[model samples]
Target chain A: MKIRPINHKKPSKIRELTYELKVEQVMCDDVITLSPDDTMNDVLRILRDNKIRGILVLDKDRLVGVVSIEDLISCLVDKGKLNEKIENRMTKDIVTVYSDESIVQVVNKFEDNGYGRFPVIDRDTKKLVGILTKGDIIDGLLEKLEIEYRQEEIHRYRASHIFEDVISDNSTLIMQYHIKGGDFKKAGEQTSKLRKNLLRLGIMPETIRRVAIASFEAEMNTVIYTPEGELIAKIQPDKITINTIDSGPGIPNIKQAMRQGYSTAPDWVRELGFGAGMGLPNIKNCSDEMKIKSKVGKGTDLQFIIYRRENET
Target chain B: MKLSRIIQILDAKILCNVQGRLDSDIPMICGSDLMSDVLAFIKSGALLLTGLTTIQVVYTAENAGVNVVCFVRGKKPSKETVDLANEKKITLLTTNMSMFESCGKLYNNGLIGGSDYEN
Candidate 1:
């Protein structure tokens, strides 16, 4: 790979990029909210129709509690609670994020609480302005990484004989490995290899650390969930990318899988000290870019990238 | 704090010798038996003190960048746990102190929790 010059002077640029990613920039402002008086039946229909897990319990424009599918499932067991008002069953202690808050802080909250989603309120007005999900943060990070990668590409192009070298010697180096499912013994093998390669290439310690965590999580996901999978690592001068493609019972609900604490692993897997449903979230947090696509009964493809030259401090 | 200092304060037994890693700096201590919670909040190079005595704890600690694990309340880990800890280069310790006391001692010794972000 053609290495690029490390920009030591603009060390704060990376931090500036992350801190500028406000909750509002990535939040879904057009939230599907339900009034407190709405019946559980109404909540059920909305959730089913939208393929969503939860609905915000709003009192007009004001923020309130959240009622989720778990609540509905428990209420269904009682049968008589079907017509009960959502306010009676909704969770009162709402955990929320402010629109102006940095994305890093939002990620910290997600890690600390293990919540699937959070209501985003205006800092000044204290009114519910949007809803932020793990998927939103992933998308935002992916966008930022893409922009940074493109800029790096431009720099590489300017620094070299662009078209001819691009055709003769591709700067990106690719390596692939096959991982078998239920192979807990060999779970982190590829991650260790990737880390070694990055270290040999002299990547920054912090960047290598994030890459190690992200690759390990993705590798474990494949080992725990799929029958078999291929892990692809691409090393570039400016970034390191890992792609996990698995063939197995695909995740039916990608949204749900992205949520923290949502795991489909068997109980025995939890005994292995995994399956807390933090794998994907942890991967997203460590990566500068992440994308996941899955088809029911088909397979899953997960891709994440970490910038090699990012500031450590 | 150093791992040696942690061992001294907790009156722990080293189950696995990690060579010079005992002299490595530990800025944080997280105590939890639930591997999920540990994975969620652990920082790099932090010390993990848990009551969980499974090989999975060692695996979790390895994945989360934790280099030292202390089993509290005198809980003994399996042979597989110690073996994995050795392979992964993670120092293993066993202490008779309760989880609360172990954490308190570390905190009293200036090893802080990893949650530095504002709540």
Candidate 2:
């Protein structure tokens, strides 16, 4: 692909939100339907009462056709009878979207077909359940985003209040998290949480960076090489210490594992941007002190420390 | 430098919504496919350029506090990766430029890389 010069648009959060929201979540289920036997005069009355631009023609519970404002205008233009049957004037080749489908697809359909509204059908039942308009989508997305913004504000407020007033000669914060093996999605979550806590405590950015990196690598190793493990961190006034204990198959060669570019990770793990044989070396490089002990067929315990020194960087 | 300026200099395409403003300045850039190297060296609020598009790349960026990640060599990540980036509020970008060329342009534009901080 050739580089496009300076015209790339960043994907909007509203656009991504569409992928997470279903059509039913935003659709108006209180649909006003015009039966096949209803006349053009009935359409005019329903359109005026509901203030809707498009109306669906239903035969009992099943949708048969759609009538738009243009159709009504055409009837007036032709000086046609207002008492004419609705289905005869309605568009038969109507397009629809499933209620369970993401709004992203609905947006695409809107663009492709140039339709003002879509009838939302239940995917499993194939029953017409609701009607959706552009206005509904915009309102739904805005409401969801507002809720998210409020929650984020609350989360930031909570994170800022890291420690409460307490009297003690020495206070150490201890955090423990269990890491499940083979769970790539949650591998670094504990470390990320720790980093946030450290930030809230007003620790130096550089110190927190080092501690986060070392702990993250250790956590990933436990998730990759063992069935399960526990990460425990002790935060002292002068330094931070982390220990990872795993009861899975232990490493037979600690020296080999410590070498850069030496990894025993499976091919699948390698494809996930890890297992480059740099985890142990990275842990060693970031920590001020490190040690590891393992027994074959048993388990392993790895510990590291990072001193909270001022002006170190 | 400003992330928008970096986008202009590298001809990059942003792939996700950023939590913060794009006009904000970043201190450094780190180019690496190995997530461990990125974790070990990258400073907070720096931009990361890598060819790896896995979910772990996003995780590494989160752990390291790197908010902006540019996937080099025209590498676009999967939907899962992009979704994760969006959820994490990290900005994702892609460019057709090679890792070497992208670094050179950013360097010429007065951006420093990770080596400047390594002791």
Candidate 3:
């Protein structure tokens, strides 16, 4: 096994790009679309020639369905005729994105649907205008970042102003993330974002890890026990404080909850290797200060703070 | 250890197509099915070995900054899990070896666990 040193300095522009860019700005407008009347043979040729996975099936400028490589393979394996109309094999239940929508929303769509690409539609005309792939988002962000880099003065201002706005006396950078219960797929996303923001801010890696782990436990608790919750982090110069507030069945006993090996998580959660009754204990262990406020049948507000002190760790 | 060498030792199959990633060195290893425990101990860019093949594993890897995840015991992830891992740029591998055997082999090959890793 060969071990390599970690690179703490990672490019932070992509995070900002997802938030700032739009689908139209990133999507490929020269879509290689096919008409529904087109045969599977045409799809095969276009996909192969274009080196693309999927092509939109359009009916007189209106998207009707989408055909992909999987569909093609299935057709071949099922011994279906190549001359068959693509409309027969194409999936009609297509999910699309409005051109004006932010890239972040498209990202969530990709994450939730697990689809390789999405057809971009114009809001007013409801016509397919472009196509978005995960690769497009990456290329678009990199392109934008490169342009921004060339405009060094604007880039510096944009990056530094975030800190300058919050680093003043008694000012705190507050970040909020919404947590949806039973949405296991989206859980821990907030913590990932928080970790990146902390890294971009040049926070100590040890401190950031502690902050992330503690918040992740809290985030998991919210996902496990609540119908919905919110994670709010207040980053100060000396400490980072996190509060996870949920309007769900609150903990009945704080003492028991804080104890190791005490969890009320369901069997399903345990099957995923969670609900070991270690969440609260892990949170308490990672943070310097911790507190919980709850009312039965009401909600729970869990808060923890990790101080940014080198001497402490 | 180099990810390629680790793959060779564990006899693992690459689950995702992420070019130029396998040649890099992996500094530490952390084996656990419990993601919360992983979050508690994982160092940045460490290789995670687990028997659990679920989307949450990728989520945990993303949150904890684990760049390489190898599923042991021939566990295979769902399409969603693989897609998410690819999007996050985390390498996914699957091995027929059990978690203990995978860890033992990696350890014998000089890959230290994250518990003993220090800056």
As a whole number from 0 to 100, the lDDT of residue B95 in candidate 2 is: 95
Tens-place lDDT per residue, model 2, A1-313, is: 1211112343456655776789999999999888989999999998998888889999988899999898999999999999999878999888999999988778767777777889989989999999998888888989989998898677655644433333477667898999999897777888878887777666788888889889989999998989999999998777899999999899899999999999888888777677989999999999999999999889999999999997421
* Candidate 1: tens digits of C-alpha lDDT, residues A1-313: 1111222223444434445588988888988999999999999999999988888998977777999888899898877477899988888888998899987677768767766789998889888898888888778867887898897666545533332355645478788988888887667777776665665555676677787777777877888888999999987767778899999788888889989999888888777667888888888888888998888899999999888666421
Tens-place lDDT digits, model 2, residues B86-113: 8777899999999999999999989897
The best candidate by TM-score is 2
- Give DockQ for candidates 1 onward, in order: 0.11, 0.36, 0.29
| Residue pair clashes in candidate 1 | none
TM-score of predicted model 1?
0.56
For model 2, report DockQ: 0.36
Question: What tens-digit string does per-residue lDDT give for candidate 3 at A217-311?
Answer: 88888988899999999987779999999999998989998887887888999888789888998899889999999999999999999998874
- Which stretches of candidate 3 lie above 4 Å from their native place? A1-160, A165-168, A310-313
Query: Candidate 1: lDDT over CA atoms?
Result: 0.79
Q: What is the lDDT of residue A145 in candidate 2?
A: 93
- CAPRI quality level assigned to candidate 3 from its DockQ score: acceptable
Candidate 1 chain A weakest ten by summed lDDT:
A1-10
For every candidate, what share of the true interface contacts is present?
0.28, 0.68, 0.55
Best by lDDT: 2
